[model samples]
Target: MPAPSFMGIYPADSVQEVHSSLPLDPLGPGAADLLAGDVEFRLHYLLQEAKKFMVHGKRTTLMPEDIEHAMEALNIEPVIVPPRPLPQAPFLAVPVPSGTSGAQQQLYTVVDDEIDFATYLKEPLPPALANSAGVKWKAHWLAVEGVQPAIPENPAPSSRAGPSRLPAPTTGAASLRPSAKQHLTTELQLYFSRLTAALIPTLAQLPNLPGNSTPSAPQYSFPDAERHRLAALASVRSDAAVAGILAYLVRWVAESINKTLMGATGTIGCLVDVVEAILDNDVLFVEPYLHQFLGPLLSILLTVPLGPHPPPSGMTPTTIELRTRAADVLAKLVTLYANGYPGLVPRLLSTFKKALTSSPFPSPLGSDYPPAGRYEGAVLGIGACGAHAVREAIWGTNGDGLRSINDLIGLLYPGEGRRNKAPLVRATMRALQQLTTPKPEGATVPPPDSAEVAEVFGPHFVRAFEKRPWQAQELMRLRKGSNGDAAAVQADAAGEEDEEMEEVQA
Candidate 1:
């Protein structure tokens, strides 16, 4: 069937336009037999056309006779037009069987109702994406060069023969050639590092760009680095190469989280997709390499939900597995520290305590640490993940993780580290605060504002915080007749003693 050109026509006016725009042979070949002259046939055609008008371009209002005659002319013996084009029919997208391969491979299928923009960005990285680095980078370069400020070459000299009066070649093509050729390899390395640093954090956040909320690929106007990366990604034959790229991407996501860079949050979804793709494709999941990616992945998974947005949509079985695997890895990491990585638990908790209590700093001003703009979500995510690990270590399987959590909280929040400029610290502390607040007997104290982080740790967080030293300090401060009472008494006595001594000296 011919694809309909009905889009862009509004329902209110399309009916009128449909009548005027009817095909030349509305009654088709059959109209010629019924009409005596061309004039009669044309009138009949117009009349038939008027009868076969559309509402909203999708729903046809053809009478029974019009349909019968039209079908006969077209040699469609049995015309089967539905009463209405039921919206539920999945015509726009076709699902591919799991075993499909080669050029027939389908990239994705949205089995659910509507795919959200963030979810599109978050969907499993296609196996095809595993090695598209070169293409991505080249496309980026092409787009950049397309917009490259056209260097006005010295208008082909006024006099061709004599020594040209052109100005000395200071820059542009003339000056760029030697360094360009020589630094080709080195420049790429440096550029990739810089690009990764600047771009990866923002990649996660880029999907959420305001106003342009629609989801589509060719994510942005392609850049040189993107084109190059994509092309490189496509060139690799072995799954190892793909895994390596994904592993690096995971590292980038983790580092971006650590550095508290902008857009780091969006990267979590992207990394999730990549990991999902690896699993879906049955590509060798390199344990050690993926291990590095796990921390950031878990951090992001734990963090982004604390923000206003929900996690990306379209949870594939592969994605669920990846997330489950990440959780498992996190449990193991915590266990490793619980068992022997002696200082890990304390360090993790220390980081969380510091992030929670620290004063808020805007992203740009705090760019050296994790910035607020992009890094906030990822930082929160990481902090939340770390908090979960701390809680799990302390309370889950054994009681050993408690002291470590206490030491971490004490050290990080200790006189001043708590006030560090990291946003993640602040966000996590916010989580910890909610976790520690007392419930009214049966009333739930309510989960922290950062719900995703809370979810990662479950109910154990409140239980664990109840025993921490910070809780004791806060309780003591709040208690009417605790040590706080003794401190007040001591101050009053000291003040009286000083006053009496001063009067005696006088």
Candidate 2:
């Protein structure tokens, strides 16, 4: 498939059939007209497919076939588009010569400044974002700025109260403002609480799928519950809901890490605990009710700092705890990702880096898998955040570092003098396994060929999976365990064998 000379722009749905090219062309002429003419047809197809992208600023990549399909959809022939290889923009796009002239630096800075200024000026955020509970999660920051925090007050503030006596306006309102810690707490609390309620329908739908079926194979059920979780998370701005969600995620991580079977029961328990904690309360999660709340809590911690913005100062303690808890949490998340949640590793790495190097948090202990005791916990959480970017080559968001992670996992496991923290390693491995395997009951399994997969798993994924012949074999075994009919047949075979033995005895 030939790459388009220019970036393409089509009505988002126009690119539904696009697999390997830029979905929308920005540099081409008459792009808007092209979109307008084919808008209805493209929209019709998109709606039929229930395609969801773009709402997240996702650029749709297309392939030759996708471009052809899109052109055909519009009753136009696919153009024999020639590849005009424009210099691919560098990730950081530094100038070739270091210490360029002041004029050059100013020119570069002006461009950046203009882009930021325009983005800042764009008002009234996407409705999906604005309507999300995330607004409440970080609303506490509003308190820091001395603004009336945005939140759904438990008693619901009365509209009849006229504006209170006003103070003179501050210039800070003109710029990007930092939110207060207390307000962040209140907002996050309210947001997750609401998310818990919203996920009920999806949660109710999980028990319906045959528990033992490969997601790719024909299945009697779909993961409505998992879908709800993803959708609920998606509905939020990545940053806004992160803090609140992290609060719950850590608990899930802690529980699963400590579990025995390290399978559905433990994983599901963690998920349930997380969902319930967010839904059921407005307070600190501590035991009986707390019983291994750390997993979900840690998950939240690892994610929030890596979210759209940095955590508020108040949430620094939470961030610190996660950093203390990170070596283990990170190892577990990586394993979980390897097992099935491979897509999540990239996200986790991003968060982990943020928590390690960012403004507020301290660095992690030198080694991975810090000690599990309380005092060790105190120093474990330091300096884990800062904007240390992973080398894009080593770990592209597309699951590139699996082999490295696999090595790391080995180091974390029992023996190797790291056995004292074996539980963390075990739980981390279980999480990885769960992530790599097909999601269990009610888990939403994304389409292997979907854009989401492509972004995380890379374009040539099936081939990549085939490359790891041994891992592929294990995946096959896991698939059988997850298959309903196969298990039934195995059960029947065992029963028949038992009966024949009985007959021989008689």
Candidate 3:
């Protein structure tokens, strides 16, 4: 649908008349209409902005000063008319000397009012006002930009005791003596250097080892790195005034994920660990960086193989666990921040859903739709979003060519990374298990019959959870899904009168 037309108060004839009064001559037929529309838009914007000033000032009606303020804001020079203005001067129409022999066009000018300068000067001298205080100057620090001087210009000790104060570098940091990056304090530069050195130890920082071919991969076991790494992670978990470093750290996370994801498992794990550490820090406010964090988290969780090439024999559980860790961070961000940031959950759901449904990579083992790791990560990410998301995406009625997870998991044909695929299956089961409605503290959740478990979660889920009967029974419990499916399943389970308690109790 087209946008509705906003009828403007400006008219074409008035614009044409104003144009005709100028030396530029009358505007063409169509030009005046266009100019009128433009004028209306500009006038509307100015007045609308002017209304803000009125509202801010807590006034009932807009004042003339507001319009002037709006003009200043828009960088337009305003016509400053005095409050007690003279009456509109009569227009003096003079015939313009157009070279053509046709009719001479008229140019209009405002008749200027005469003033008595001698009388105004005589009137101002009537009373002599007391001389205003002569200008004098004094200065104290309002806010210092960089390293403060040792002089008295600095605020005193009691004044410097506020929470905004930056911490001084330790003796170790003083020896390193790293210079501050633009606008960053010496303290933060030292902290970031130590932290990166500990957590993401690049090969260049170490001595050139004789046998290593992979030069750039991060060595997590670098000399003295682990001790410093633990200290760095602990510091991040409790550091104050780190908000200034947040943007740089987010950029670092993104860049490191892109560079290290295909090369080394340890490096990627370190990145996720740092993310979790930052999230764990109650001192640093992360709300501003939530959106930025999503890109790196999604990259970690959804990117397949997690290496340049597939592992020769079996997928490393360590590499796969990185996605799990990333999912945990993803969940922490969504579960905690979703309420404050509207659309965050839906956007996350859309991303995971897209990845979950994408076409499979052709593998020798068998194409199990999308890559197994990505599928598992997507499931975990959605599950992290809480019950509503898990309920809809996994168990809700199919739409947009969607199928339930019960149906989807069954389609996981014998594929590459099949060993690691067990985790994928387990991830699915874990997500569904989280949806069980809470029972009273003393009460127990009634388990559906084993025969009904196959009916509710499909044959594949029963097989997946067959050995662990309680898990399948957990899925069979009343789900927190919004639709009637969960209730229907609950009712069907409730109606089974013939089952022995001993049969399902096992």
Candidate 4:
């Protein structure tokens, strides 16, 4: 079929149809063709002018307002109809069919209005009517002094309140002024650029090692002069404003890591350092921003394929180390805000359980066995949350937790031992040990005995081993020897402490 044409040209057939419709006062010669062509040209001109209005409004599409504005600009009067009730149809009840079901047997009401045939047969349209309130131009400001005021033209408030606490207002007359946020945003952008530049260099190789690693003395020193300057500026700022700035920075860093494959390690490292500096600065406030920080921090911790474009072979050591640092930041956040935010621990644990179990690659021996850096981060994050969280995660509602733990064990130490994800397995073990370890204050419940552990895990133990035949012995050792070994290790540590004390006295 040929494509339809609508380039403003009226067809001859349409002109003939229009001429035929009007018979009482028929057009002579080529009058119908001339009228149709004129009408089409006028419509096309109106549309073109409307598009110009749209362009002035910084829009690509023409709207009803643009058409109205165009008509006014062109000095064209629009036909306005007076407010009148629309013609109503007479209601009639129709009988239901006998064969219909009981539910469908009810009478149906139908509107059957009588048509005015004469109105359709009219030779020409009635004279263009003008209503009592005829179209007239009214002027209003779309924006005033760089701010769209809450006037009739712009009634809705520009700033919306988010779920988090509202940011504290700045001092002076600026608080009452409009566009104050624009100024703050400009200032924050400047600060963020400076901070990003300063921090990016420190990211590749931080003066202080991340995680548990610590040098006897400072391996390297932070550029205190620069850091102190930034911290001082941040300290004097309002808590809410500083929080907003940090939140934006966090989002930027996360986007850079997820969207860009190159420089992911440096980006992640820079993020970790920024967070550390914020936490370490006693002068700077963080409470108001804690809620905002949770999501970006969690995203950084658990984003699958932390770097989409890894080394040609696999993940580089830098990528792995970057992920480890990210996980540590997650743990720190949990510790800092777990008490204030009751839901933090549960959510973190849930993320861990999901990451550990949900994998696209089924076989551990396959090239894709390691999963993503985020999955490993989840494991480390869980361990950092504390033992109670680990217990709840592994022993979810109604023994679901026990099943999840068994699944991880099977995946990590399959019987065949084709490939062992050492880092993942070690993280899981650390979480388990943390879960089972006794607390000094007895705040948490003591670890369950061997009998309980066996009973809870026994049902799936055989099936898990069956999938990986080589890991049966390792599973057995985990089940039988974990408690005894933990006890012995504690005893040995105590013995060494006693010898140290004796040497000190001598």
TM-score of 1: 0.24
Question: Where in model 4 is the C-alpha error above 4 Å?
Answer: 1-181, 185-190, 202-251, 257-263, 312-320, 359-375, 395-420, 436-506
Name the lDDT of candidate 1: 0.40
Best candidate according to TM-score: 3
Q: Residue-wise lDDT of candidate 2 within 1-506, one digit each (tens)? A: 43223233444344343522545545334434444445654455544322222222254643344443433332333324434443354344334543646343211322222356676768765554555444244323334465555565422356537334322111111211122222235555556555544333322343343453345756665465555555554544233444444434443234333331212221233243344434333343222222243344344433322211222333222322333344443343343333443234444444443433323222244334432322122112111211122323123233343334334334433254533543333322332233243444654433243343334433333343443334344444444454666678899999999999999999
Off by over 4 Å in 1: 1-260, 263-268, 272-287, 294-343, 356-506
Candidate with better lDDT, 1 vs 4: 4
- TM per candidate comes to 0.24, 0.20, 0.53, 0.41
Candidate 2 residue-wise lDDT at 18: 53
Whole-model lDDT for model 4 versus the true structure? 0.55
Give residue 246's lDDT in candidate 4 (0 to 100). 52
Instruction: Write the residue-wise lDDT of candidate 3 on 326-368 in tens digits.
Output: 8888888887788986568987899888988776565544544
- TM-score, predicted candidate 2 vs. hidden true structure: 0.20
- Consecutive 10-residue window with the lowest summed lDDT within model 3: 125-134
Candidate-wise lDDT, in order: 0.40, 0.37, 0.64, 0.55
Can you write out model 1's per-residue Cα lDDT over 1-506, one digit (the tens) per residue?
43223222133233334544766535434223322233343345444544544332355665555554443332233423343433554534564556545334355454666868887987765443543332242222222544533334322334436443322212112222332334235544443344344332233334433322345544555544345434433333234544423433444445544443122233333344334444433455434344465566545433422221222453222222333434444444454335443444555555544543355444333233332322333233333345464334233232333333333344333344433423323333443443345544554333233332233332223434343446433422333344466788899999999999999999
Task: Point to the candidate with the largest lDDT.
Answer: 3
RMSD after Cα superposition, model 3: 20.8
